[model samples]
Target chain A: MNLARTTSTTKGKECEAVPSDGKPGAVGVDPEQLWLRPTEPRRGRRPSFSREAITAAAVTLADAEGLEVVTMRRVAAEVGAGVMSLYSYAPDKETLLELMVDHVSGELTVTDPPSGDWRADLKTVAHLQRAHMLRHPWLPAALTTRRVPGPNTLAFLEHVLAVLRPTGLDGAAKLEVFAQLTAFVAGHVGHEIAQAAVSRSPDRAAAEGRYLAAVAADGSHPELAEALSAPGRPLTPEATFTRFLNRLIDGLDTD
Target chain B: MNLARTTSTTKGKECEAVPSDGKPGAVGVDPEQLWLRPTEPRRGRRPSFSREAITAAAVTLADAEGLEVVTMRRVAAEVGAGVMSLYSYAPDKETLLELMVDHVSGELTVTDPPSGDWRADLKTVAHLQRAHMLRHPWLPAALTTRRVPGPNTLAFLEHVLAVLRPTGLDGAAKLEVFAQLTAFVAGHVGHEIAQAAVSRSPDRAAAEGRYLAAVAADGSHPELAEALSAPGRPLTPEATFTRFLNRLIDGLDTD
Candidate 1:
């Protein structure tokens, strides 16, 4: 039913579209149809399940498995619906992903207002985001694209904007800061999670160590060899995140 | 063949594996076999094509179309080989991806040595990476995983290590800096490319503007409303990148 036209009709929404993986022709979800419209089917008889149920199911699958396994058929099976029927709720996997992302963003509930120390407040914001992404590991990748902010995401964005109010940066600058901060956190957490997985597998970690040792011994990479030889105190992922976050946030110029 | 055993046997190589997509069980390519092993098939009569050709073809495909369209079968067809035969070179799409990422990295040729100003040098290193990722839009997603550094990637890494030598950061810190910088650039480019795509489509841009306007009008998103209303001097992607890069690099503490 002219899906392309329907999806292409909306743009410049809050969350950026999913990373296109360099696919230039990719179209993001229409915010109007996706967010503004009714959650249930308008014309058909009331179904036993709701869109929220479907989205929750998809999020569960992604959390347990990975984004790779959250297929339409798999998600349908989880919700006890036919694949075709699931189409009525989320036209495709992309739409389902949009739904899944927003569904999980519901957890980013910040009750306290900004503390007025913008940098300190922003650090807390990033920490909140990092923890949230780690809980729902699929989030960082899901966030790489343009996403229309669903109700939950909007609420979080509103809070972040309020936090930035003390900075006196223009509205656009505040928005840019939020987007960049989110991207930075996502990138850091994505790496941190992958590193954690490697650390979990002792065999893999040892193998990697040996592999690097061999490379260092090759003489061509003297700097690497020296770096490896005098390895300093190993920092935890949380420390690294804070270190980088401080650098990024502190470096932001209000002028 | 025991594929799992073969892949899990090697780790701690230079390039981190592809982003595990939060998949804990994901194993990276075996660096020894992938990088040190001969390019030609060891046993059988050497096939008509080389590993380099297969990787190049895959890269071309990914460049023209997104990473999603690059399948083993498609690559085989492009190289005029059977899909089964291609497996001898790259056992799976993951391995092929490892190959392709390193292959494109060959383009990141840095002729000058570190300029003594480690921050400036690191900034240059990041800018080079930003441009490289932009050229291969799929790189950001691919770099999300742990990858073994093949010869090309190793060559580039060696250059970066030299640049970091001035910082007096321990070898581990140097390595961490490089990884973080790469992730930051990938994250930025991924978002930049997606935003560019939206900008290219006027219809989509307008729809997004309308969607956000509606949200801003909803009273609940006052901060979003103000931010949208006064989006300051629209910054170019390059300027935004440079701004963020400065903050990140300048704020990096050598102590």
Candidate 2:
């Protein structure tokens, strides 16, 4: 009946609220009985700053500029709040980084895991993930899956498990399958973007032809050697990517 | 009778050499000449920088400091040379980058392609490549097939091709297989080293625990969730790496 009163510390200060073995306010504080002045039923919230809003703005800034320019003060300014106020939502800059990753994780759209053909389901998931990377190229560098998977990341994991459940593999086998597939997609996707970045680079283009010419003059790398000497057909990144992804998936399906 | 006396242009400079051609310096410059050295080879070169010395110093700099810090000035200082004088050996910074990567390539120890199971041979190449990455962590970021393969890299590729020749995959298929294996290994290795770097960050030790605790809160995703929480059964990088590699290789045996 008097749990709050009985739990007062020896210093006569209100200690951390503890459960009084099912007494009122014991474990769960009831919302209906929150006491307040008649004119205003409850306390007004702090300035409207949710983790979601902060993350969205951070993503925008990162996309517009780059990840290197993402600072706490800049994020706070983007969110229309003082830097100190923003710290209340995210404890530190690192915490903000984690939340930003979680935000991108929320963007992955999952499909109903397929039942009849596991290969199709895996491909669908792979393609969807590729699309996600294209949408937020910065996410991969920001969101790291270390010892734990965040909520949205777990949802992706859940989708993978659901799709793999129909396959004959057990838990360990399924886990291995997911790991390889994710690594394949992430690795390949990273390469694609990096190559794209370099393909546009003037330095890369200027150096590429000259180096090939110099080496092709006398060097011997057989295929490359011959190709360099000849008026060669360079493989398009898209063609290379298509061939690689299909073959890897095909190889995966057989085993 | 003087087929050797012809005018050619290369690098925006007209040259008087042998058979004139449209290509740069294509005055049929002596087929045997590696560098465009001064005619009477500059002797008494012992007191200053040499090409071998510059490349070796650059390789050491990349291995110790990251590639970004391996500036021309810094490298020249390391060799105790005037900055402009260093260029006499390296030609240019791009050439220096190429030489640095080529020097690292020289260390890749590979065997003749195996004659037995194709997948087995592929696995050997994969492991060897992984070892090279560990030996030179800055490599994946610096080197690519588009760049000249250098001598040892060419040998490694030849071994891979020889092994996969029996797999019945065409040129396109061979390229795909190689791309998948190498990109997967590079991305995975980069991710691993990145984790180590992040762990060493002053903030990670403090922030990492919070992120880990929140995500592994539930007994979630079963196997993945289990791996995250199992006491004294921490997933070591080597163990995880081997697991992924085995799965990928096992999946390839069907071909």
Candidate 3:
């Protein structure tokens, strides 16, 4: 497949505007080229590798290592392809990330139809998302940026819209609900993951505890000091997520 | 400042465990060394620059550019210091990021005490954070990772903890609420910024519209089609934020 042919329409001027460094304002993947275009090069001799194979390789690398390590060079090495050849499929890391995000989103398979209870169904959707983000720890950060919904993402979104059907929300409102719910979950899960990491490192956790203790004792933060002194029962990450999720979802008003 | 002397205690085996690529689960900045330790290197002759100057330089670079551009080398150049000398202040980009987050947080000065209404006060806090994040677009992403609180952050946190004092919640729960609120604001601002970027690029926006239209036209996505067709009044990002923030905050139960 001709790489230039695939992305040339949206690649030239617009690409310059889009920082390829994976920041929030970067132009998203061109949906038509990425999701609608043919996976194989139309006019060229068949390449040995598939786009699916490359995306999978990148996802595996991200899952095992981190997003930073899944660079074009590293992903190509993982898939036994030349770095130049990888660009034919994914022009840059940004495009690759879009593919990776949509690829993992395929796992969000919902067989059950909306149970007619919008609040309950929405909560279920959030739980599914929370679990999914935990599985792909990089997702919360990746999602902070805009991603044009690929086929898999669109399919999952369809389910969410259907679940929200009972809310009688207009198209935009329903969409906003989904986006807000997603951002909320992403925020919660990111914090949860970071907190879990702190827990995993005893020394780091201890250092933090001591530091906070010192801060609490500083007299200037009397409230903090009191809060620390009268600590309450600890909640698991899941419990905390559920508590916050219920608040956000249940507070949603159809009117 | 002697970088080795400051960091040696936490830098050896533990540093290996932490991925320095700015992912969650990377050991956070040590609060004692980073915040409590004197800014000046105690043993060595005074360096040409102070840690405050280096942090300010990096913040300026990040404000104009993005976080990805704020490398140790770039920040050093910005401050007119050698990269090696820059290490004395911030050993790595991660540490610099922690500094930047705390530095900008100083802008979040709440002169008026909490208005006794915990919910109203919390809403004010969220609004303040939203404004703060908008000023420094890099903040939303930076906060995704754990940052040990420096003096400025602690001061802001002290104010927030005081606001939550009226909630009658214990210390741990109060702390969790602040963390959750901060995360929520970061997530919302990130989405808002990405959406704004898309709107700024007419070509990208048109392409996206065309792509979504094609998807909506496809018979499989009937709900999406209906929603897009009946798109109601579009809420401004601020309106949307306030709506969701109200839902999250109003639904918080003291129990």
Candidate 4:
């Protein structure tokens, strides 16, 4: 995460991929290389591995280990291919990342057409995204870096656009809305994941609860204390997601 | 980056930190150890550095470089102290991260009292947060981990709670609202930072534009093509942030 990579109008998180040389790559990928370039299979004798198989292996690795461990060598080894051979399939770790992203995105099957109630449909979209990210725990992080939608991701985006069709937003606003919604879901889910981990330990949860209690007892934090003491609805993760998602999608104004 | 750590209620992204010993620390930190634990000044001599100084040095390193480089050794070196001495200030990188978060959070000063219009004031808070993240690009990543608020973070949270006071929300909901808003801002700014880096490279931007055009040209993605072709408002980052923030805060329901 070389936060120092700066240019005019710069926005977003730094690239997650660390180069083998142990240096951060320039903040973003070459679009032509990532999107425009076509993958060609070897024309010689039949290749031992397919890009799909390689990408699946990489996804499995990330799903099992984490994104950082999805190096070409490990991915190639997982697929029983030579390290050099993997390049024909994924060129570089960054490219593999693109593949890994698209691979998991296939799970987001938009079987139901948009219900035409765009807000409800958008809520469903958020729910699906939350579930999808839950399944692929690395997804929220993967999406944070600069990504070009592959076929699967583009398909999902198309579905979201369809859901927003009634909003009468211009093409760009629709795109922006989709991007915003996805970011909101990812952010919520990421925090949810972290907090869930903390809650798993009774000691830690108790400690946090106690700490909040103590803070509330202290006179300076009257608002915080009052809030904690107030009776509240059960904030199951799903319920929390629904509340926030409604605030976002229902409040959206095409104008 | 450990995407694999799972439990019964496992939902989203995994832990960002990997323990050196290849074991997950018993979930979360004890609140007492984190907040209430007193730092005993070394007996031998007057300490040359304050906790504030060490945290500031770490924040500087993260701001200039990135979060990955703000190690104990490097932070100590930056502060002109021995590596061992740094531990007296920050027991570990996690503690240092908590400190770094609070340190940068000091910038979120709420000088103006909350306006009677809570929605508008909440928008201001979001705007302040977005600007803060832009200044410290490392903040979004830092926020993803489980953080215990230090003095600075709590002060800001207290201000947010005060802003939400008119909403008639009990204490927990106010806290939830604050957390949700912060996460949203961090998520948006993180993406904004990433996108800004991509826009810096005209070649890459053009390639992305062209690729989208080609995708839109293809018959399969009609909604996508239509959306892309539509004349849209100029999406300046600030404008985008305001648009989304309004949807979130305005749609917020206290009941």
Candidate 5:
């Protein structure tokens, strides 16, 4: 929505106070309305309710109890406000998630600026994207982002694009490369995080372990069994991120 | 789980007799149990519930209702059986899902197997992987597969490793490449599927239309905006998938 105008209910006679029934909600200058920050808030004061506060609360709930528990009323209550008040900022739970997506996206650092080497540059960018998603595992489930690339996301895309520019690929190819590269990194990280959550369940993990032992008992799939048994090198998003980047770069730029 | 020792209650029934229970539970078969037919009161039977049947039912649920809804009770309902009885075949829902994962992975076909041309071979394998995930969007979400690859998954990996065989990369390097490639392909498909789901949402589609209108108003972030608005080509998983595979291949393989 129109994000330019933010409202901050007046500070009243008591400092550090927010009026429940006061003026328009606190909004900020974030025009994308990406974080669902209030539309009109003056400096040095807290709004009665805010998108950031709600999302933070939701994130906490999700991290602790899993995503299924992060409902609208629950998040609203967490923020010490009514569902209606929370709605004033997030409008709906899905919208609140979108805001959360942008909020988490903002945590990634673009760089002092992207370096010029397309290969090195891309590796760096991939690592950062992985790091961003890892910090907010809830983000992987928010796979379908609308065309609204928030400020932070815009920056991330720009930085990657900048790195690719020096590689000598034209806009169309570059766009395709960038899109594929990102999809790989994002998809990979999402799998890892979600899998970890599922595996963390004792019943599930135990069952999986037994199944593995049973299946491998006959050694029918030796390569497979060895793979299953290997104390494998742990792959964070960064390493997998880099490896995929290499694969993509190696696959592209025959020039 | 005593997988091999499992038995199907459908055996030993007479050909023309009506089912005794009238509850219409699936005649589940643990073929490993070798209880091909029950004794005494054998009757005519409907199709039996194998792990594959349960897995297919689970996949169908996930495809239609999203992953969260694919619970044990729901899957049992779909299979026309009691929830507790599912443990005989699936042990737990996670194992059931693992069965589903392997079952779905079984759908992938790498026809020529892997060739010495690692780049070309990997490219071929990559496309097959992409196609499989694309067909089943819920797959990438649940394919947690940590150490032991399932039967179908292991075959796929074995095939992938064979492709890397000619790359002259060592075990660790080959493993990394394999992991990276799978992650990349899986991750990319995950995004595409997630986005497809998003576009399917009326509210999101409406919000997106609004977001696009806003973007048009601002007339900034030209590349981002262009990428969003351009009608250059159909936005399909196939197009992006191929592009990404090429990019990764180009980025790797200095040989």
Candidate 6:
């Protein structure tokens, strides 16, 4: 579902904020500058650190300590570069975030081309994303914020687009499918991590179980009570993911 | 899909953090206490502010200034209560957040019981959730953290269970369907809000467009190029939500 509504109130504000460049809502880095421009050092003394090195350090920091710890100063320190030198490459935290996302996206290499069974291939794409996001728990949050794909991210996107090629859906539908799939994976992974954290404590687990049981015993919630009373399956996260993913992809329509 | 994996590495730290009370993550209000026990003021004197009034103030502050500003001090000031006094009801920010989520959930009143067409009814539930989250931009993030359905939240969950009753799925599946649906809505609305914010800036929009155009022209990205070159439809958020929701719900298999 397209949850983004183009309401009149929002449109009014957008109109006033639109810059005079005849470009509407083009507020972030110019894609031309980000994607096409070379990251050459200024014509001066030799550069101390590469953009790739800085981004790798940031990603490493985020993986260990979460995204909040990956500040410009901290990232510079992580790579043993001066903050000023770091700015020459990323300019700001936002740019660094973009760089970090793409740097990690290099991990998403598709060894097999689309299997012609686009639905099956799409599921594989989603599985890869779920695993990737699990490895980088902060990714779901990073992704929800605005980002323009760097070369590595674009490469993964290209692979996804190829996976959807045989579906015969128009380009827009294909793009929407990919976006929806990614959102789904991110959302699921985020929930999974939170749940995992809670599930670790037996005391917490027992308390939660008791609470639900008590709720079921309460007469007012018949349906809830019934549902709680039924036998449950393995309820493993992977199984749950597979079940939900199958429903989502299988239900996709080309028209 | 269940995105949360049970990674053993995380478990070691969690075990250490488990509290001695045999109720580790029971750091939040005990569900039994919250859902069942009354919030009676201490025996000696009357409470200066009702829990509802305090929660309402928190919700109002959140709706206006966003969640970050709805701290205990700010919320206490908003309701003209002392910070210490506010603690009598919601002991901390997490508790206040639980109250706020349920406080707003009072808006989700399902007038009709679920129609026999479970899929159609489930879609309706999702639409309601999407609209609800769009109204409160901070809600998606709040939901991601943690929340046990206080009375208001439980009421909505009860209705969702009723709606899923005819699916012939067991209770666990029904609960899962509801959880997945909520997660999907939160994820979509969160992305929608971010996109809308970016769309308001002409420079950012133009930059993003140019980046895509450049990518389309680059020969390595044939599938992406084809997708980018293809003519697009209205691409409104509501339409997109409906399309994706249909895919998700329609694809759901009970087995």
Candidate 3 lDDT, B159-235, residue by residue in tens: 99988887888878888999999999999999898889888878789888988898888677888998999999998
Best by DockQ: 3
Which is the leading candidate under TM-score?
Answer: 3
Q: Per-model C-alpha lDDT, please?
A: 0.79, 0.55, 0.81, 0.73, 0.58, 0.73
Candidate 6 chain B minimal-lDDT segment of 10 residues: B1-10
lDDT of 4 by residue, B1-255 (tens): 111111111101223332333112224444455565434433565666777788888988888877778788899899899988776655566766887787788889788998989988888889899999999887877777668776677778888888899899876677778878988998898788878766765666786788788878868889988987785766888888888898788888778
Models sorted by lDDT, best on top: 3, 1, 4, 6, 5, 2
User: Candidate 2 on A1-255: residue-level lDDT in tens?
Assistant: 111111111111222232223211112111111111022213445346666688789988876666656888899899898987666555456546665665676777476646667777787777777777656665545432332344566667767867765665555456556665666676666556655654555444444455445544544445444433442345665555555555555555323
Residue pairs that clash (backbone atoms under 3 angstroms), model 2: none
Error of 3 at B43 (Å): 5.0
Report the number of the highest-lDDT candidate: 3
True contacts kept of 1: 0.55
What is candidate 1's CA lDDT for residue B142? 86
Determine which window of 10 residues in candidate 3 chain B has minimal summed lDDT.
B1-10
Task: Write down the TM-score of model 2's second chain.
Answer: 0.70
List each candidate's DockQ score: 0.43, 0.09, 0.53, 0.37, 0.16, 0.33
Off by over 4 Å in 2: A1-51, A64-97, A114-116, A139-148, A167-176, A198-210, A217-219, A226-255, B1-101, B109-119, B138-176, B191-255
Q: Kindly indicate the candidate among 4 and 5 with the higher DockQ.
A: 4
Candidate 6 chain A least-lDDT 10 residues: A2-11
Residue B229, model 2: lDDT of 47
Global CA lDDT of candidate 3, please? 0.81
Model 6, B1-255: lDDT tens digits are: 111111101111222333433221123444444445433324565556777788888888777767767878888888898887776665456666877898899899888988889889989989999999888877887877556676667778999999887778888788878888888888888777767867776667777777787777758789988998884674888998998899889888677
Ranked candidates (TM-score, high to low): 3, 1, 4, 6, 5, 2
TM-score of model number 4: 0.85
